[model samples]
Target: MAFRKTLLAAALALSLGVSAGPAQAEVKIGFLATLSGSGAALGQDMVDGFNLALEERGGKLGGQDIVLLKEDDQLKPDVGVQAVQKFLEKDKVDLVAGVTFSNVMMAIAKPLADAGMTFVGSNAGPAPLAGAQCNPGFFFAAWQNDGQAEVLGQFATDRKYEDVYLITPNYQSGRDQVKGFTRFYKGRISGEVYTQLGQQDYSAELLALQAANPSAVWVFLPGGMGVNFVKQYKQFGLMGKIPLLAASTVDGSTLPALGETALGVYAGTFWGPDFQNPVSQAFVAAFEKKYNRIPSQYAAQSYDSALLIDSALQKTGGKIDDKQAFRDALRAADYASVRGAYKFNVNGFPIENFYAFEVAKDAQGRVSLKTIAQPLTDHADAYAGNCKY
Candidate 1:
């Protein structure tokens, strides 16, 4: 009877959150993204990238099994906040990653910082976190909100576009992008329009743009919004009349739908299908084999995020509870990135390159983004100057 009682007590202790041994320990990660609605494609690609990395590692990171919980933010701040609250307060997850949209990230950045949880952001680099509000726990594995846009703006300046019109979704990222574009483009402002976020119908905006007839039109729409806007712009027969220069408006995420219609649309990016590096080649081949679609900047950034986590875990021997050690390990960024060159700046955002890409048909006659011009090399975010640590 005594032996049976002791065994029962041990079982009770194990059930009450006592780990029997190190073998039983696992890393709990909560990955939240806008997995539905207008931003679904971007979030889906990010999830795929992270999953592919885990699959390659046999579903383990840093020698410990990962207990990953994926949640959909639905592109709404309130919904994202509720989901993050559960991850931080209830589940007590060790890490947080994969936020596809900026609005959701803006909503939860503060809470994650106050709780002292690390966010290995795969996407969505909001400007505030890269500046005065920067925190040690928030590491963005993607470009700053304005970095790519600044490249596009510089491209426009190089081309000597005299009058340019800007259109973007009305949100934090949208504002940041426009600010980046105008930061370099020494051009006369023809017009500026901010559309409702996640808006599907862009007829009014397209018509207004045609009426303006500026020397060039710059936009920052992504995902479904890009698809709809490009289709409408073509339908309204304004394709060749005014040049379209964009950032995130014409890329792998929307190219499947836009097809030949998106051909010749110029956009700015950091990675694409044509990257020749061995790491990039392997990642693209594996992603294509697994997903049967071309990997976009979305996938590349998220893939780097997973790789960064794996490398950091290797340094810490899979231990994540020691906040400073894990933070230091991540800061080291000892990993082979899918993008050619990658490292975190003082602000925790990436110091990388951005380039110009054009929508064109490859040898196989399928529409793809092709590298065109070198825009910004070893580019750091404009906000990094304000960050201390």
Candidate 2:
């Protein structure tokens, strides 16, 4: 009778959030990305990179068991909202990570802010969030949408290209890309064109560029869109005629399909496979060995995102309940980044170096991003001044 009474008492205690068992620390993480359709490779690479960091840490982050709940948003805003709702209501994740598209990020950003959940973005940084709508809970592992473009634009300007043409998809990121490029580029823009997102055909755009006869063309297409655009650009004989400068339009994920067409393509990026930093070298070697493919900037950023979380968790001694405390920890940015030294700004964005990378054959004859020069140094986003947080 005493044993029955004790069991009942324990059950009541458990139901009231008191446990007789020892408290085990666990951190739940929700990862939302576009892991379907033609752009699947990008999201898949990001996830793989994130997992590799966990593998190195023995599947634990910051001495806490990490429960990663991954969901595919299918590149849809509504679907992304649904996934974020599930993460907040059902999964009760401590952190939300991995948004590969700006639209999707926009769809879920407000909810994450409202819930005060820490958001570590692996990809897709929209401008509004970085500026006026900035949330203290958000930290971008990747640069703001305009960051890469701004670097590439500076590269074009330095190259002394007098007349340059710009092309991007007609979306939030696309508009942001144009804004970023023109911010640093002082040269005349011969033409500015916007195509449909996930557009497969670029013949019309090519014709416009040909007619414009610009000295250089800066394209902001990504994923399969980049692949198609590069192939068509080569076919149109503009590959050699007009210099091609892009922001992540040609990368490791798309290089295999691009093959010879991607050769000599200049890009502006934050990290490269051949970067000489110890942590970066380690991550690059491990990622290539495990995936049997070169990791893209997307993958690099995702990996950094994981490392960032782990660093914060360690700082807080595996306790994530205190929002401001955890936010302060993340702001420290003390971890060794694959992109070398980086520090968080007042707006929770990174102030880091941006470099120009050219597609070149490595010792193994594999296509890789070879660091050319640092175009932008310790750069901070333009919209940071407007951030309330």
Candidate 3:
């Protein structure tokens, strides 16, 4: 009887211990991006960068096990909204990250804000979110929608590129790109053309640009759109006729496919592999060693996003529920980033220096970008003045 009672007690104790074993509470992070279609490359890069950071940090954020729920918005605003809704209402994600397009970010911003969920944008810095509609919950890990374009515009002005033609997609973000370019570009405006969003064909636009014969062309086509534009631009023989000065999109993500065609393109960006900082150097080396390719500004931005989250969590002692405290910690910018120096703007966007880069073949004969100049010094986006939060 005694032996049976002891065995029963042992079994009960084992069951209780199993039941009480460290209550695993999962912190779900929803990553919504254009996983298919034209923007898939950018999304894939972001995922790669994000996962790299997570792996480096041992798959934990804020001292908790992270459960990442990935959804492909396919560059559609409606799909983005639906994905965000599902994440917030059903999956109960602690945060939403990795939006690639401004339109998609705009669509889900207010809803995510209302839900009191943290929206950490790995890319897609729309103007509205930086300005009047800015919310405490929305933090941009990338530059503001127009910040890099504004840098490009200033670079063109300094170079005396008169009669510049501007081309961008006909979307809210595209419009903002043109506006940003014009804001600092004091030279004569040749013409402004807005193409359909994600339009694969740019032949008509090229013809128009050729007829205008602008001294320089400024374009803001990212992801697949950039791929299509560069290919079409080359086919039309516009590469030799006019110089192209564009945002980072021109070569950062498209260079692998663009190959020799991306040569001689000037791009302005906030981060690049050529940055001479120790942190950036180590990051570039490690990233290349692991991925067997150079990392783009997109990857750098996403990597920073993950590190920022980790830093904030560490600051708050890994408390995810203290949203206000978490935001404060993130705003403090306590972590070291590969970008060298970056701090949050009053509107929660990054306040970082912007550099102008030229696409050129490296010693290894691989196409890469080289930084020429820092166009913006301690720059702040124009929209930040309007933000109350």
Top candidate on lDDT is 2
What do the candidate models score in CA lDDT, each in turn? 0.88, 0.91, 0.86
CA displacement after TM-score superposition, residue 192 of candidate 1 (Å): 0.8
Candidate order, lDDT descending: 2, 1, 3
Error of 2 at 353 (Å): 0.2
Top candidate, metric TM-score: 2
RMSD (Cα, Å) for all candidates, in order, is: 4.8, 4.8, 3.7
TM-score of predicted structure 2: 0.94
What TM-score, over all chains together, does every model reach? 0.93, 0.94, 0.93
For model 1, the local distance difference test gives 0.88
Residues 97-196 of candidate 3 have per-residue lDDT tens digits of: 9998889988998798888888788889988889999998878888898888899899998999877999888887898888889999999999999988
Q: What tens digits encode model 2's per-residue C-alpha lDDT throughout 261-364?
A: 78888999888888999999999899989989989988999999999999999999999999888889999998999998899987778999999998889889
Poorly placed runs, candidate 2 (over 4 Å)? 1-23
By summed lDDT, the worst window of 10 consecutive residues in model 3 runs over 17-26
Predict model 3's lDDT versus the native.
0.86
Which pairs clash (backbone N, Cα, C closer than 3 Å) in model 1?
A: none
